[model samples]
Target: MRESDLIYILAMAGVTYLVRMLPLVLLKKEIKNRFLRSFLYYVPYACLAAMTVPAVFFATTYVLGAAVGFFVALFLSYREKSLLVVALAACAAVFVAERLIQWIA
Candidate 1:
């Protein structure tokens, strides 16, 4: 909120940027390691799975209906279905599943 605080924040950001950028610039040609390359290849999938798994189970009924919804959408899309069709199917699955469960209980 103050002038010195703003200056300090700017300097910190500059240093952080340099720290992150310098490593890539310095290591770009040096990292010919196969293990690191393989690690990088799988990191994105690993991150996606990590985030999805926890998020899928974080809410009511473990977001169970939504998980089924996402799977149905993903599967149908994989089969060359239109995105809109897959999305509607998934939303329909969630709505129907939720209503059915509510009705049964």
Candidate 2:
């Protein structure tokens, strides 16, 4: 790799590291506010959903398969299934949907 490319990558790595690390280092006291604590507790799940939802819609060739998978996942999740079960159910739903689509077409 070029020197400039190495420098740019290092700079990006440093910035990303600092952005994540500074928060923990600066906030030494335990959070006391109930509302803030609750919000913080759910932040990771919220972030995960935000990141994964869009990808789910576009992950397959056909929108129908993706939609089927999404609804299966949503239903299993609402029913409080284990994470592994929910994931496998969604994958199976998508696979079946895709095969059905292929057979029909």
- Could you tell me which residue pairs clash in candidate 1? none
lDDT for each residue of candidate 2 in 1-105, tens digit (9 for 90 to 100): 899999999999999999999999999999999999999999999999998878889998898999999999999999999999999999999999999999999
lDDT of 1 by residue, 1-48 (tens): 899999999999999999899978887575578999899889999998
Model 2: CA > 4 A from native? 52-55
Error of 2 at 76 (Å): 1.5
lDDT of every predicted structure (CA atoms):
0.79, 0.95
Worst 10 residues of 1 by lDDT: 53-62
Listed in order, each prediction's TM-score against the native is 0.50, 0.75
Residue-level error in angstroms, candidate 1, position 39: 0.7
- Model 2: lDDT to the true structure: 0.95
TM-score of 2: 0.75
Candidate 1: misplaced stretches above 4 Å?
A: 1-30, 59-63, 77-88
